[model samples]
Target: MSCPFAQSPRSTPNRIPKRSSSERDSIYEVIDAAPLCHVGFTQQEQPFVIPTLHARSGDTLLFHGSTQSRLLQAIASGRPICCVFTLLDGIVAARSAMHHSMNYRSVVAFGTGRLLEDEALRQQAFRLTTEKLLPGRWETCRQPNEAEAKATAIAALMIEEATLKQRSGGPNDIESDLSGPFWAGVLPIQTVIGKPIPADDLPPGVEIPSRIASLTTSG
Candidate 1:
């Protein structure tokens, strides 16, 4: 089933409305593809935007931090939150400076965070997060000990309303400037997984797991 996030004034895009979408698949795709998100909220009349790792679990988003983190504490207080996920695809160079733009997929979601108190759900979030960052990693690595688990805080945001905005392809230059002296094209951008480096103090003879090795191959 698709996400049920309804459109609201806060989730609507006034500028470049054509680029915005309410489609659940589109919104979910961007969220799942993004490795990190910026969560914005206001605490005590002061605005704060913090970037952190994130993972999507069904229609809800998961994030975690140190138990004492101010951002996590603010989020778990049920304050209004604006979480944004963005993926930059390329830089659009146009013949005219004003026409330059970037190709990207982004989502702006509105919700209020809630702490994941249940042990099972909290463990599930941790697994999903680890697998999201690196597939098959959770199974290969040692599970978090009780102390480690207790020191971390996990929260969920049940996306109440959200919108997806995206732009693709090359720059949109004016007709007169199409053939101008300046070049116009897209400088493609991508996130590449580089070769893995072993830890300096790691025991010798431990080979890289297939899951880690496959990243570079796929990248």
Candidate 2:
């Protein structure tokens, strides 16, 4: 099915201005690079925002948790949810405090979570999630057992509406502020993965998997 967001006119209330194909790519890049997302929803008149790992499958976003988890249960109830993912690229220092800003890419999506009732779909979701977390490791690792799958609750959110906001480069300092005696530039930031440490009980001759080895540096 086509993405719901793609079916409508561009006249919508969104904070960010997404007017180009490159900007859409930036949105997807941020979502793919960030492993965690904050899901916001309300339960019993109380608002909640929880962080969890997520995987994007085409126009749908997948996430799972314990079957008995209150958050998962709430989501499965069909209430609307707001999913947010962001990546901080740098800090912009400007001569004027008002002009100071940061470089970031963010995606805000709105959808209602649907529980994956079909066993086959749930299994597929699990596989997709695992692969997204660590590519090539799922093939080498053992699959989940029936009992484990039974205890897990998987859900998919069809991205009905979404918006992407991004800010890059240095601060937009005014002409007068540009002449001030103050340093102004972007302080680049990145997330790096350190060398993997083997488990204490790891059997001998078991070398690091290619997926793990590849994570030794920032990808």
Candidate 3:
């Protein structure tokens, strides 16, 4: 049931660097903090990429979209896909230009995608996806109608070939360039939380929940 990427080394190709325990730890952190991923694949030898919402169950990443979606159709046809989920923690600044680099954690997964058909499993996948974006959104939003559900497409990708790489240090400038006066360094960046905008159609008396308010200040 697991993607090929999550399998032992003997089971899949190693396209990226072998991930150490430290690297693995960082991957989990980055993935958990984000709910979207960039999926790359080739259709007819032409490269294609798409951004999709995803949920990580243990080591497998699940994606669901419209059945007629070009991306989903490509995957269902057995095309190989490369999924990259990344988090940018900060940009590093270095005294020398050559040494400048950003701090980042990312996971690259490759595999063939497939259509998910089990009714119960699809419901579970829907729930997992809902919980990832919002703690209790599924319960709050109106459930999907039969027509809506029928129009959707659910997919599960096996992590076959994968690796996690993280670069997070001062600067990697060459020793010779270290003496250079040119200013160079990662410009540390972060995702900032802003005040929540209440829904325009929301009832006048419905108060903003503390949870929604908290997200505004949360990293």
TM-score of each: 0.96, 0.89, 0.81
How many clashes (backbone N, Cα, C below 3 Å) per candidate? 0, 0, 16
Best by TM-score: 1
TM-score of model 3 relative to the true fold?
Answer: 0.81
Q: Rate the local accuracy (lDDT) of all candidates.
A: 0.90, 0.79, 0.72
Residue 127, model 3: lDDT of 83
Deviation in angstroms for 147 in model 1? Answer: 0.8
lDDT of 3 at 183: 73
Query: For model 3, how does the per-residue alpha-carbon lDDT over 1-219 read when each residue is reduced to its tens digit?
Result: 222235446333354344332234555666777668898888778898899888877656778788889887877777778888888878888776455667887777777777888988788788888878876667767777788878988887766656666677667667777677677655676776687777889988987666556667642
Q: Per-residue lDDT of 125-170 in model 2, one digit per residue for the tens?
A: 9998898788777888899999999999998988776766678887
Off by over 4 Å in 2: 1-26
Clashes of 1: 0
Q: Which model, 2 or 3, shows the larger lDDT?
A: 2
lDDT of 1 at 149: 95
Clashing pairs in 1: none
Highest lDDT among the candidates is held by which one? 1
User: Against the correct fold, how does model 2 do in TM-score?
Assistant: 0.89
What TM-score does structure 1 among the candidates reach?
A: 0.96
